[model samples]
Target: MPGRMERMRAERRASGEASFFYREVAFNADAVKVMPGEYFVHSEDLVITTTLGSCIAACLWDRQAAVGGINHFMLPGDGASDDGGRYGSCAMELLINALIKRGATRRTLEAKVFGGAALIAGNGALNVGQRNTSFVLDYLRTEEIPLVSQDVLGPYPRKVCFFPKTGRAMVRRLPPAQREAAIALDQDARRRASASAAGSIDLF
Candidate 1:
C-alpha cells in the first residue's frame, strides 16, 4: 500500500500540478520539483527544488504572511507570447500572483535569485544566461520587490532548494560531469521556445 506521503503526492499529481511532490529525505520534509517553465507556491513546510544551466530560478517570499513561491524560467521574456513560466516576465508575474492569492502582500515581498550561468561558451548571441539575469534584476527593480540575495552569472550549473514557509534557500554548484545534462536541457527548452508561438502574459 502507498504510504501517507505517497498518497498525498498521488492526489496532487491527479490535480494537474506542473511539478511532482515528494519527500526530501535530507530535510525529512515534503518537497516539490519545479522544472523549467513551472512554478509552485505554498504556505506549508515544503521545499521546492530545481536544476538549472543557463536558466534562472527566482524564489519570492512574503515573510509577514509566511507564504512564498518559486519559479524556473528558460528565457528572459516572451517578447509578446505567453509561454507560461518558461519566460521570465510570465514567471515573475505568475509567482507573485500565486503568492498574493495565498495571502502574501507585494509590499513585503523579498526575492532570492539563483542560476543564470554561461554554460555555453563562444556564443555571445546564445548567452541567454546573462540576459536572464539582467531581466530578473530589472523586473524586480521595476516591481519594487527587495532582492535579498542572489547567486548568478557563472560557468557552473546549479541545483537549488527553497523552503517556502520559512523563506530559506540552498544552492549547490554542480560538477562538470552534470553540466552536460543541464546544458542539454536548457538548449532543448530554447529550441522549443523558438518554435512555439505562445500568447501574451497577463499581469496581476
Candidate 2:
C-alpha cells in the first residue's frame, strides 16, 4: 500500500490539481526526472534531475524550509503565449509557487542557474542559449530572488542532479557526442516552435 505522502500525491494527480502540463510519468524510486518544459518541487531529499544543451535549468531552494524545485525552460519568454511552466515566465512562477506550497518563503529562496551553452556548431546568430541565460538572470533580479550560484554559457551540454532537502548537487559535462544529441533536441524544439501558429510560443 502507498504511504500517506504517496496517497496525497496520487490524489492530487487524479484530481488534476498537480498538473505537469505534459504527461505525468510515474515517479517511484528515489529520484524524479524533469523533462523539457517541465518543473518539479519537493520537500524531500529525493534527487531531481534534468539535462541541458542550449536550454536552461534553474534550481531554487530555501534552506530554512528544506525545500527546492527545478525548472527546465526552452526559451526565455513565452512571447505571445500564456504564462505556462513550458515558458520561462510560467516556469519560474510554477517553481516558485510549488516551493511556497512546500513551506518555503519567497524571500528565503536562493538560486543556482545552469545550462545556456552554445550547443550547435554554427548557430551563434540564433542566440537561443544567450537569451535563455539572460532571461533567467533578469527574472531573478526582478523577483528579488538571490542567485547564489550559476554555471551558464559555454559550448558543452550538462546534466544536473539536485537533492532538495539536502541541498546537494552534481553536474556532469556530457561528451561531444552527447552534446550533439542535446543540440539536436533543442533544434527540434525550436523548429516546432517556429512552425506553430503566431502567439503560441512558450518560454520553456
| Candidate No. with top lDDT | 1
Candidate 2 structure quality by residue, lDDT tens digits, 129-180: 9988999999999999999888888887998988888676678788977866
Clashes found in each candidate (C-alpha, N, C closer than 3 A): 1, 4
Report every candidate's CA lDDT: 0.83, 0.75
Candidate 1 at residue 98, lDDT?
86
TM-score of every model? 0.88, 0.82
List candidate 2 segments past 4 Å from native. Answer: 3-11, 14-29, 192-204
lDDT of 1 by residue, 1-204 (tens): 986557656664311134587779888988888888888888887788988888899999999999988888888876445467777898888888888888999999999999889987766755788889999999999999999999999899999999898999999999999988888888887766544653322111
Model 1, residue 155: displacement in angstroms? 0.4
Q: lDDT of candidate 2?
A: 0.75
